[model samples]
Target: MFDTEREIIESKIRLCLDCGKCTVVCPVAQHDPEFNPRLIAQRRLSQNSHSPQDETIWQCISCYMCVERCNYYVKFPEFIHGLRAEALAEGAQLQCTHGGALQALQHMMAREDLLQDRLSWLPQDIELSEQSDTIFFVGCAPYFDIVFSDLEVNTLKGVEGALRLLNRAQIPFNILANERCCGRDLLLQGDREGFLALAKANMQEFARYGVKKIITNCPECHYTLKVDYPNVLGDTGIQVMHLTEVIAPLVQSGELSLGELEKRATYHDPCTLGRCSRIFDEPRQILRAVTGLDVVEMEQSREKALCCGASPWVYCGAVNRQIQDQRLTQATATGADILVTTCPKCQIHLRCAQKSRDGKIPQVEIQDLAFLAARSLDIGGESVG
Candidate 1:
C-alpha cells in the first residue's frame, strides 16, 4: 500500500515544471532559502532511494502553498506526505514539537473501547439534541487546550463560540460524546495507518448516531472530513461544512442578529479553509455584517495569505517563528486592532507568537471568527475580541 501511494505521489511530482512560483509563495522558503519546492522535486526525481532521515522533507509545513502556486498542478504537499510516510516506514524518528504527547493522544483515541469526556467544555446553557441529523463535530478542542495550555490560549473558547452561534441561530445540532481527533495531524505527519484507524473509528461512531451533516469550527477537521475521509473510506453519505459556511448565511438572512462592534479587524485565511476549500467569501461576509466593525485587508489576503507557521504540531523552529512574525507584522500593518481567523490552530499559532514578542512589535488582538461572531450576538458575557 505504501509503495503504491508513493508511486502515485511521485507521478504528480514528475509534473513539476521548475518555474519557481511555488518557492516564491512558500512561507517556509521565504524564511529559509535552503527550503525550495522546485529543488525538492528535482532531487526526488533524480534520486531512486528514499531516505527517511532527510531533514528537509519534514520542513514543508503541509501548507499547500506549493500546490496552490504550481502552474503545472503538481500537488507538492501530497508528495511530501508520501515521502514522510516512506521515512516513517524506514524507522526514521520524527521531531514532534510537543514531545509526541499529542501524537500519543491521537493514538490513544483510536481505541474502540476508550471512553472520553470530550464534551466537558460544552457550556451548560448550550442546547443540544439527543438525536439530530446534524452533528457539531467539535474537533480536538479538549486535547488542544491541554497541549497548548502553556500558551494561555483557550482553544475551547472556539468551541464555545461555535456553540453560542448555533444556539443563537436556533440550529438543532448534536455533540458526539465519543468524538475522536479528526486525524489531520496524523495524516500530515505521515502516519497513514494511524489516520485511517482514527477515520474508521470516527466514521463508525458517526454511523451509530445516524449523522447526516457535520458542522466543524476547525478548518483541519473540515478539510479532513470533507476531503480526506471520502478518499480513504469511499462515500461517507454525510455532508461537512465549516462553521462560517453555516453561520454566514444566517447572518445575511437576518436569522442571526449581530451587535455592533466598534473595531477595525483583519481576517487571516487558513490554508485549508481558503486555498484548499475555496471558502474565501463566507468569513468576510459574516464579518461585514457586524455593524460598525471595519474589515481591513492585509497585503496577502485570501489565497495569497501566509501561514501561521506551525503545522501538525511539529517541526516548529526559527523558520516557523519568522513566518509567524512576518504575518503578525502584516496584520499590524493593516492597523487593525484585532486579527481574526477561521481556524482554531491559526488563532493558537498567532497568539503564541503574540505572547512571545519582546514588546517591540505592536500586539494585535488575535481572535477566532466564531468567537467574534458569538460576541457580536451578545449571547456571551464578554467580547472574545
Candidate 2:
C-alpha cells in the first residue's frame, strides 16, 4: 500500500513543469520563502529516499490553493497528505498547536464504548427525534468550545444556528446520542489509524440508528463523512448535505422566510466548502435571498479565496498570522460591516486574528453564515447561550 501510494504521488508530481504557480499561491510560501511547493516537488523528485521527518511537509495548510492554481491539475494537498502519512509511519513527531491537546482529545474519543454528553449545547426550543432516518452530525462543536474558550468565540453557535433552521423549516432530524469527532483533525495530522478508529466508531453508531442521510453544519464534518469515510469504510449508502446546501433551497424557493438583515457583508469561502467540496454558490444565494443584506464580493471570492491560515489545529505561528491578517485585510477592504464564513474553523481563526491586533477592534465583524441565517429567521440570537 505504501509503495502504491508513493508511486501515485510521484506520478502527480512528475507532471510539474517546473512552473512556480504553486509557490506563487501557497500561503506559507508567501510569508516563509523557504517553504516552497515547487522546491519541495523538485527535491522529492530528485531524491529516491523518503523522509518522514521533513519539517517542510507539515508546513502546508492543506488549503488546496496550489491545486486550484495548478495548470496541470496536480493535487498538491493530497501529495502533502501522502508525505505526512509516511512521516507518521516513521514515528515522526508532528508539530501540533495548542500543545496537542485537541489531537489528544480526538485520540481519547476513539474508544467505541465511550459515552458523551455531546448534546448539552442543543437549544431548549429545538426539537429532535429519538431516532430517525436523518441525523444531524454535530462534529466537535462542544469540544471546540471548551478548547478555544480563550478566544471568546461561540463555536457552538453554529450548531445552534443549524438546529434552529431545521426546526423553523420543520425538518425532522435526529441528533446523534454518541457522536465522536469526525477524525478530520487526525487525518490531516497523518494519523490514519486514529482516523479509522473514530470513523469506525461513528459508522457503527450511525448503523445502530439506521440513519440514511446526514445534515452537518460543519464543512469538515461534511467533507469527511461524505468523501473521506467512503474511501476507508466502503460506501455506507448514506447521503450527506451541508447546512448551506439544505438551507439554500429553502431560501430560494420561499419555503423558509428570512427577514431583512440590513447590513453589508462579504462571504469568505471556507477552503473545505469551496475548493474541496465545490460548494460556491449556495451560501451566496442564501445571502442574496435575504431582504436587506447587501452581499459584497471580496477580491478573492469563491475558488480563489484564501484560507483561514490554520488546519488540523497544528503549525500555527507567525506565517499563519500573516496569512490570516492579509485575508482579514482583504475582507475589510470591501468596506463590509461583517465577514461571513460557513465554517466554524474559519470564524474562529479570523476572529482570533481580529482580537490579536493591538489597535482598535477590527472594522469587520466575523460571523458564521448559519448565525446570519438564524438571525434573519428570528429563530435565535447571535450568542451561543
Candidate 3:
C-alpha cells in the first residue's frame, strides 16, 4: 500500500558510518557471530547474492537494539520490516514457529465474516460494564492457551490477573468478546495486507463498541494498538493504554492495596514494552508496590535490556534458545528466585528454553508482572507471583 522499503532504508543507509556498534549491541549477533548488523547493511545495499530472502534479513529479531545504540539513527529493524514486505511479495517466507499455527490464528481473526469465540477465559467475578466506553482488550491469549499448551503456560491467567486488578481499582471496562489478533506478527512477517485487514476490522470493532480507550496486558498488543494502528489507519479517536500504565498510579496513591510477597524477583523488560514503547518504569513500579518483594536488576536493563528473542514469532532456533538462556542466566546471577515479565511471549520463550535445557540453566520461576501484582491483592482470597 506504500512505497518500497528501499527509499526509506537508502536515506538512512547514506548516513550510516559503517559502524560496528549495532553488531556489538545486537543480542542475535552476540549469540550467533555471523549475523552482523553492519555487515548486513553492506550486503543488503550491494549487488551480491545476500538479498532480502537471505538469512541476513530474517535473522534480525527486530529488538531495535541497533537503532537504540546507533549514533547515526539507522533503523535496521525497520529496514528489515520493509525489506521483508518486499521479499514476501517475491514468494519469500519466514520459518515461523509453532508450525505457523500462531500465524494461522492471526489470519483467521482477519476474516470479516468470522466470529471468534474469544471470551472463554474471562473470570466469573470480574466486573464488566456494558455502557463503559473503555475496553480491556484481550489479545491472542485464549488461542495461545491451546497452541502453546506444550509449555504449560496459561496466558489467560495473566489476563485474569490484569482484569482482577482493574476490578479492585474500581475501573469499569468491557472485554471485546470478538477481539481479533493485533496483527503485529503479520506485519512483521511482511503480510502487510493481512495486517491492514485485521487493523481495519479491529478499528471497526472499536467504533461499533464506542470504544474511547483500550487497555491491554499484552505488550505486543499494547504497542500495536497504541502505535501501529494509528500510524496505519489514521487517528481513529481510540486511545490505547497498557494495564500497567492504568494501574500504577492507583498503587502509588494507596487506592489499590497489595499484600506482601516475600520473594526475590528480577524483571525482564520485554523489548516491545521497554525499548519500543518506553514503558520501562510502570511495570517495575507495580512490582515494587508488592510489599517485601525484593526487585533486583539484570546487568542489561531498560534501554540496554536483552530481548526475549521471540519477536514476530519467526525463526525459533538454537540462537533464540541461546539468548533465552543468557537472559535466564542473568536472572540467576542477580540471585532472584523469580524472573518477572509483562509480556506473555517473553514468558513462553524463556520457559520453553528452560524446558529444553532441563536444569542446565538456573531454575528461576517465570512470573507475569500483573499476575504477581494481582497475587498480592487479597480483599478476601489468596494469590501468588
Alpha-carbon RMSD, each predicted model: 1.8, 2.1, 2.0
Model 3 quality (TM-score): 0.95
Q: Give the per-residue lDDT digits (tens) of candidate 2, residues 1-385.
A: 1343763465387799989999998988999988999887777667655643558888899999998999998988777777778778878888788899988899889997799877766777788876579999988878888888887788777688888888888899999879899999888777888988999999999989999999998999999999889977788899999998998998889998877788989999999999999999999988898788899999898989999998788778889989898898888889998898878898888878877885444548887888887877676555322
Q: So what's the TM-score on candidate 2?
A: 0.95
In lDDT terms, which candidate is top? 1
Which pairs of residues clash in candidate 2, taking residues 3 or more apart in a chain or in different chains? 52-87
What lDDT does the true structure give each of the candidates?
0.85, 0.85, 0.83
Cα deviation of 247, candidate 2, in Å: 1.2
Q: Judged by lDDT relative to the true structure, which candidate is superior, 2 or 3? A: 2
What stretches of model 3 exceed 4 Å from their correct place? 6-11, 47-52, 379-385
Per-residue lDDT for 96-191 in model 1, tens only? 887988889999999989889777667788999887899999888788788889877776777888888888888999999998999999988889
Query: What TM-score should be assigned to candidate 1?
Result: 0.95
Give the alpha carbon lDDT tens digit for every residue of 1-69 in model 3.
Answer: 445555455438657789699999999998888788888777777787334356667878888888888
**Residue 354 CA displacement from its true place in model 3, Å:** 0.8
Model 1 per-residue lDDT at 5: 68
